[model samples]
Target: MTVTGEDSVIDVDPLEPPLCAPLRRDLGWAQVQRMSQSAGHRDDPVLRQIRATAAVRRGTRMTKVLSAAQVSGHLGGWLPYGFCYRACDIAHLHDPQELALLGTDGAVSAEVAYALRWRAVDPLDYEVPGGPAQPGLATLQAHNRVGAMILGTGFTPSTDDLVPEFVTAGFADLPMPANAQLIAYVPGGEEVILYTYQPEQHGWLRLAGPRWRGLLDTLPGVTPDREYVPCTTPGSAKLVGQIRDREYEAVADPPEEFRVRALTRAARYPVSTLSRRAEQALWRGVPCWVLQRDDAWARLRLVRPDNDALAATGARCYERGVYESWAPVGELADHHIADIPYVL
Candidate 1:
């Protein structure tokens, strides 16, 4: 593929193998740099000069490595919204061990790692940072502490190793695409797919078996025998596409990346699970999901609300059905994932 830049045109072999082998060890930022340079990854000027808005093709698989906290939050019902990368760009780094290197932001974490895998449903919601189209983005990044760190180190532990990082426009929380997967990277470099989201049924289909069922015990309200749990929280953004003169929910399910292991064979699990679990809780008297949290503060978004609830909390709308606010960690009440019944 020929990518044209302002000053030069570079040829990228469509079939060229991965730039490097899977990173084996969890290394610090300084060590990672030395390793990259020693491996000659920094010597390829084509990689450095390559600049183009990666096409957000429908059905393209996207992967976001999650921290241990993020994994717990998601299982506790937090919708994912933030930065992720196209799977193809980092195909060589998909191994569980290699993923740990990326998940910890290269800082080395002794805890278990996790990742979210979903498909691109709409092109409008995704954008490649520092691409040719977003010239000013680089300037904006330079003024921040994150940008300062990047400038001083010449490496972005989370994204720089992999090119063409994409973020959701406005960082808006989006609805979980059907069959979105939650994966666990255990100690022995094994990937345990814990659950798969079933949009049609509005629940998660548990995929883990005997050995890995122990992982479910950690999640509050999740049980091994219960195969599905309701998670129909109202979302802020959804993708709809018209087909055959009718409108319906649109989903991008790339066959290769959207399969599950069943017995001895891998196959696409049909979305027909029934919901069973029932539990709900609130934070500060409002049903909300914790988007992020620290010792002092927790960022939350409303799960389902009416006008009165919105007015009471002073939460601002991020999009339809999505409202968010920052609450003091001490003042907030215990929050739990709501298991509301599915309506449609």
Candidate 2:
């Protein structure tokens, strides 16, 4: 088969290759660019341009497209071809067992997006337009069903998952105590602490003692690292420093080059929503700053330390931030800077 732009097709290429590779090759460029312009991906540039072009070719207004897997990480029965599930898969999410399949680390993260259907189970679990139904949501606090979930008889991790050992290590000894439904709650400002000395790294970073709670209302301006004043400094300062430290070896304020890339990309989107996302992405690496080069709409940067991250995020900054485009990253990186005074 031939893509619209490329005339040649490789022969004997199909010995039933991996699911994503074939689908990726066959997809129209528009979808690929949609992926780049999508969440903070930094995917292949060829893919980004093709997707971007395809998006425009369809119409002046472009809708982003992503592979099923790109939409989320691997799930029990999902593929680029079909049987897809979003990161949210609430049925899996509600149960700690199912939540274990989330990311490569299988650690608890806010990343998962429960399927819209799962909202029926607990409308309060997710944020809904006009602010999720807050009425009956209070009921989730005490009922035994609060954390209830359904799983396969012996749902063990498979090769399809990133964290095969997660289930065995995490809830294996979480004090079932007759398989209690709720894990008990700790009040706000309670200085809650949880720990383990397991010889595995599940999170992107590790900390020794109690870390600052990023949530303001819960701790009321308490910083994670008490080495520095908490409420006095903006959390954005710490976050920007953290991302830079991770993406790059050093931890300093973002440079002008970073901010310029952010501003240029944010220009591609509507400021009402994505500006904040653009600010946050500044440190990730440069974004797909679309500029007219020889009359062709192309990404300003060829490759970046992190690629395709900002565009899709930038796009999602619109109204609800569900479906993506490289918009949100651009928005956060570009907009949030104003709020972060120390970085200035």
Candidate 3:
């Protein structure tokens, strides 16, 4: 399906009130630090405010800036499933170059940066940190940041100036939402949209024009000529369009940020091959990407081979530079994709 210039734009009025007021009013870095040190109960006013401010309605656009490595992983068919913030919260950051630095910790990179965007499906999945429910977790994160600084790693400590961040509850991963976009921020402040997910076709539709097509070379397993690369991975969230009082899934006209002129010239080419990458899963409380699996056993590779992961799963390197072990299907926790959390 071809979408032209004005035809594809979804008009979102800037004045429209968001589902919930911005949390900045109720929570700040100061409040975060205070709550992190307090032994207050869950019903504390500050805690309640944090929870209320974090509430999101379905269809709200969420974004997560992607590192260069993450961009390659997505091109290799890794589903997005980690920390993301509501797009409306960061709307004030108009400069594409400045916005690109959100995920990179202000480190200017030689390579291009990217972002993953998807609409919200369920509010329960997102959680505001430093809330009463997870005070200890927040404290630990603060301590870790300080430790990093002491170790001369140049980690920025949380302060009153930073914005509040959220995480997927229990760090669980969600299925990619339909219409999720992979956008690239080039060096010269140009926001080049590379691909948009097509739910019905179950693949990413390459929308980068000739000028931007060169960026595809940086992504593994992706090329400019392959207009559609089939991905049958399941998605739980969807972009909803409303006409009058009726609602429909995967029918929403994309926002102006998502509609590029290249979309008009794009064609839905046939996909002759399918990706055979194994889905991500959790085993013995450790995250892993499946290498091979069957009804009873799964040959899994650890997502993070840190000491904690090794101790939790007893995973060992059977071959040089490869850490993996066989885990029974019954022992696996959740058969879901995992993304690296962007913690504050």
Candidate 4:
């Protein structure tokens, strides 16, 4: 992965937002300092043991991804027209040259299927400049993901959920391992974002706001006001007129589990800073309440309750924790909080 100096064509610093100072008092900072000190000290056997194991706990933060040049170079000529690679293709690319490219030609569907098969063999082994995992690149190359559906004018609308069905059926046709799954996003309306998952384990992952905003900036002509519309059904015949291919099979039903869960059960996890007012608004819609996962972090969904746009009509924050999990109380347990120990 090439690391062009700050003068590169893609000016990263300009794309980033300005940093702000903390608002807390000295005692608040002192508590954090003490925690850090205690965690760093290796005197107690129990603390040391937990810290050792915690080192392996994969950080859930966003991963750096490749730019357009890196995606094309790494694909090594496998790239297709109108199918330029974007950073969104690989959610975990740490280097510019090590992107997990997704082909968009009719072959794109098939290629992604093959990639998933490759990723399924004890997946999570890929991490550039390998550490413990030697086959990280290989594993990364094995899985291809279409982060968001962005087709130009297409022929007829599909009957099968184009994004989801295409992924699942495409993988099903390949000789990939049974464990392989396909995930695709269909951005329809602001209220409804469709997540199609196949092989079950393949679940929906929301793109961070800033990252999604970056994607909009990357595509030259495509602006936020008019992003591509998601194809609702497969083999809609409408797309045939837009493109040349129509051989891919469609699915019987779109995967709706993730969508349902997010609205009904999964905890609301935002990636940007939200004010206290916003946090309260978000809480009113759902039964449980929460702040950011980590106190040091600053995302509105994590800290403040969002307005009516995100939370349901009557939710509230039941518990609070610093730099902890967004766990609600009193209402039905948000299934999303079971794994998290710290509550915010």
Q: Tell me the TM-score of each prediction against the true structure.
A: 0.53, 0.18, 0.55, 0.18
Clashes of each: 0, 57, 0, 43
The model with the greater lDDT, 1 or 4, is 1
Per-residue accuracy of model 3 over 169-226 as CA lDDT, tens digit each: 4333454555788888776666777888765555788888888888888776566678
In model 1, residue pairs whose N, Cα or C atoms come closer than 3 Å (at least 3 residues apart or on different chains), thus clashing, are: none
- Each candidate's lDDT (Cα)? 0.51, 0.21, 0.52, 0.22
Per-residue CA lDDT of model 2 for 1-344, tens digit only, reads 12332444444222111112123455653443344332233335443333222111100110111212322221111111101122211112343234423322213323221210100111111121111121111122221111211111111123232110001110010100100010101222122211111111111111214432332123223233433221111111111222322321111111111121121334322111111111222323443222112232222211111113333233221111111233232333332222221222
Per-residue lDDT of candidate 1, residues 57-166 (tens digit): 65667777776556655655556565576666655564555676545223334445678878765555565433332222333222221211211111234434634456
75 in model 2: Cα distance from truth in Å?
28
Instruction: State candidate 3's TM-score.
Output: 0.55
- Pitting candidate 3 against candidate 4, the one with the higher lDDT is 3
Pairs clashing within candidate 3: none
Q: Which candidate tops TM-score?
A: 3
Q: Per-residue lDDT tens digits of candidate 4, residues 1-344?
A: 11223454543322111111121454243332233233132244432222222111111111112233322221221111112111222333222222222332222221112121112111121121111221121122111212322221110112211110011110111111111221222232111111112321222222224434443333233233332222221210100010123121111111111111123224322212111111221333432223233433312222222233123432222111101123333332332421111111
Candidate 4 regions exceeding 4 Å error are: 1-59, 68-123, 135-218, 221-223, 228-344
